[model samples]
Target: MSSATTYESTSSGHMCDMDRTPIRHAEAIAARNERDEVYAKEAKARELLRITKRKAEKTKLALRIAEDKVYKYRQALFLSWTVLGVYFVFSTVFGGHGHMQLHLP
Candidate 1:
């Protein structure tokens, strides 16, 4: 997909050769195109890897957040149970009546 413009010397019956070597022939263009295709594939693979890594990171973050929530819930449950036990102990020691009270609003 490239255009090459060459000027011919009419007086000398010669042509200016900008790319004269065998390595710089039409085959070189095909080789360059093949190389570009390979490079494109490699770039695509790298992009996919980055996306996969990001997904894994997000999953890990979500798991950590969930663990923290569960830990907090357990701590709260333990604290409430301890408070209930303390209340029961104080009532028994003070000889409180064994009557239950419920308040509704």
Candidate 2:
């Protein structure tokens, strides 16, 4: 009888431990899943940030190129106007018969 009682008690204890094992395993798996989800979100955010930064850099470069083109065009226009003005002055003063000649009778 004593041996039988000992055996029953040992079996019940083992059964209880067995019942708790699966619950513990489930909790651990849930915690790991949560951690993996957080890591995935962080990775996605980093990728988005990198893409945005690259676009901003491209835009800045494009703006600089446009500004450089505008500066060159303005310089060319100013040079053309100056040349035209000089040509007009020379033609008016020296073209055809001399306008400033003195006639001594």
Backbone clash count for every predicted candidate, in the order shown? 0, 0
lDDT of 2 at 79: 100
How far off is residue 45 in model 2, in Å? 1.2
- Provide TM-scores for the models: 0.59, 0.65
Cα lDDT tens digits for candidate 1, 10-101:
35666445545544777899899999999999999999999999999999999999999999999999999999999989888878745556
lDDT (Cα atoms) of all candidates against the true structure: 0.82, 0.83
Error (Å) of candidate 2 at residue 101 is: 22
Q: Which prediction has the highest lDDT against the true structure?
A: 2
List where candidate 1 sits over 4 angstroms from the true fold: 1-30, 99-105
Residue-wise lDDT of candidate 2 within 1-105, one digit each (tens)? 554333343544553355566799999999999999999999999999999999999999999999999999999999999998887788687873476678999
lDDT of model 2 at position 68: 100
Runs in model 2 deviating more than 4 A are 1-20, 96-105
Give the total clashing residue pairs for model 1.
Answer: 0
Report the number of backbone clashes for model 2: 0
